[model samples]
Target: MTDKQSKAREYVLADLVDATNEVDDAMNLLTEARYPVPAALTAHLQAAREQLAAALTIAKQGDAYRPRCAHQCPNHAHTCDRTPTHLSDHRDQQQKGTHTCSWPNEPDHITIRISGGSDDLVEVEGCEGADEFNCWGIGLTGWRGDLIGGTDTETLRIYAIYNGIWTFAATASDESLPMPDWPIRITDHPDVGHSALVEIDAPAGTRLTNVTALGGDR
Candidate 1:
């Protein structure tokens, strides 16, 4: 994720914390207030607090939800002493110039895991193998995972690079797809020339849990 994206996430996470703290502080102030406070105004405060509580519950669902590590340290001989959050995406290690969790070097045949997070409209694109934009000679190239009930809908899409054209491969939304869709294969499709790109569009209310996406068969 970019620094801007990370900062946006930080603010998102801070919402619940800030809301709860505000309520607590308000209650404390109310208790210490020497002057008479109107019951009507207090009722409004109580209502606002209730709304914040509800919002927090909804936010917490996405807050606890996040995309897990896309890849782990392929170098088992060398432990990835870095934190889990750092290894969640290969790009992070790549930018840091660390090999602790070098997953980007080998993005093909990789599996994706969806754990928890908001349906914050996330989009990512990547190519597999030596060729820059083709799925040829590559195994499966998609993500397969389950969802936690947080929104009305969620969708996963795939596009194949056939003759330099991004063509639609397949799509699944909510429970439309079953468990273990092993690989998003393009080997059968003759048009798949060089590489394939998988894109996921998650809205604000989405919560995917217990997810896994592998480029090759498990």
Candidate 2:
């Protein structure tokens, strides 16, 4: 590679390494607390640390070479300053290893247009099964540049059957959309549960290339 290209690659690599290492150190500090730490905080720390690690891996594998992203980025075509996450192999083999559902072997084949889900939405069948779809969550592609995942980080309210069809709300970090692509169980979220249907009201003209669902817990 030319000197300029080499410098660019080094810069990208440094960014990746710094991000991953910072998370690792923070997690260590939190976990090595002198006093008791809240389980919730600890859990969040670990997840962040893992995400950074994964991003580092992808960068090492040359994600910088991907098509130039329209958004601001130091490297050519790279989207997020940090590694954009996807379902990991372990996660795929065992949807967080917390629960299971009749999840498709892959994302939905047919493109689904989310015009508020009344008529133009897709559903994961067999979710009616008790205990199935425990960490019920849905996501689509193109929420991020070309990535098939959620929009900016967000929290969402969903209807699920705990005893009867009930409403549950969940949140994700970092500008994540209400319904992030990550697996999130809909119970004991920061909301009141009431008998209602899962509501999906995305902005107008939002088209989803594919839909994915699986069982997991927050």
Candidate 3:
């Protein structure tokens, strides 16, 4: 880890310790001060504290605890940086293409295009002011990226034109479009001023073409 990352992890560990302490204090008062706390509630607090401790243990390991690539990859738990060689035992099991991290270590903004395609996957090409699709999260964009209809972030919407009709495919953080075989069209809120088109099945000679974004503030 870099000096900055180590420092950040330390800060996170400290915050977790503080939170654990707070929970312990609450449990103590309920059990020792003769307060008539419900038995079930105290049990819940104990469980919460245990969960926090488990999280703290994992946090202490820093990136060592993070998955290296796709979850199904055999070396998923191996602590390789951006360019670590694949462990020999798992050579045949490695992911195709160059090794890529399963996650973006930083925030991922949702201003991108669909730059590539595969049998079952479409590459989300992050553009200026955005980060590449890190292999984990809701759909294409990971947890940090703003989904077209993600409720937690600035709300915009993504629509799909299929069989001569436009249909809603996303509406909140937990909702997003499935990998599409047909051409995809997105019309952003007029105030947002962004429009996009994605073709998952382009002509044979061309790559899955364009997630071209028209003029916008993104």
For candidate 1, lDDT tens digit of each residue in 97-206? 34452223442333332211111111222211111221121211222233322333434433221112222233343346442222222211233332223322222233
Task: Summarize candidate 2's per-residue lDDT along 25-58 as a digit string, tens digits.
Answer: 7678877789888897677556545443444454
Worst 10 residues of 2 by lDDT: 138-147
Greater TM-score among 1 and 3 belongs to: 3
Candidate 3 residue pairs that clash = none
State every prediction's TM-score relative to the real structure.
Answer: 0.27, 0.31, 0.33
Clashes of 1: 16
What's the best-to-worst order under lDDT? 1, 3, 2
Superposition error at 87 for model 1 (Å) = 21
Error of 3 at 184 (Å): 27
The C-alpha stretches of model 1 lying farther than 4 A from their native spots are 1-7, 63-218
The lDDT per prediction is 0.35, 0.32, 0.34
Candidate 2, position 25, lDDT: 74
* Cα lDDT of model 3 by residue, 1-218, tens digit: 44644554565566557767877887878878655778876875675575455545655644221222333322122223333354432212244455444433333322334421212222344332233222221111111122332223233222221111111232222235442222222322232222122212111222212121111111
Best by TM-score: 3
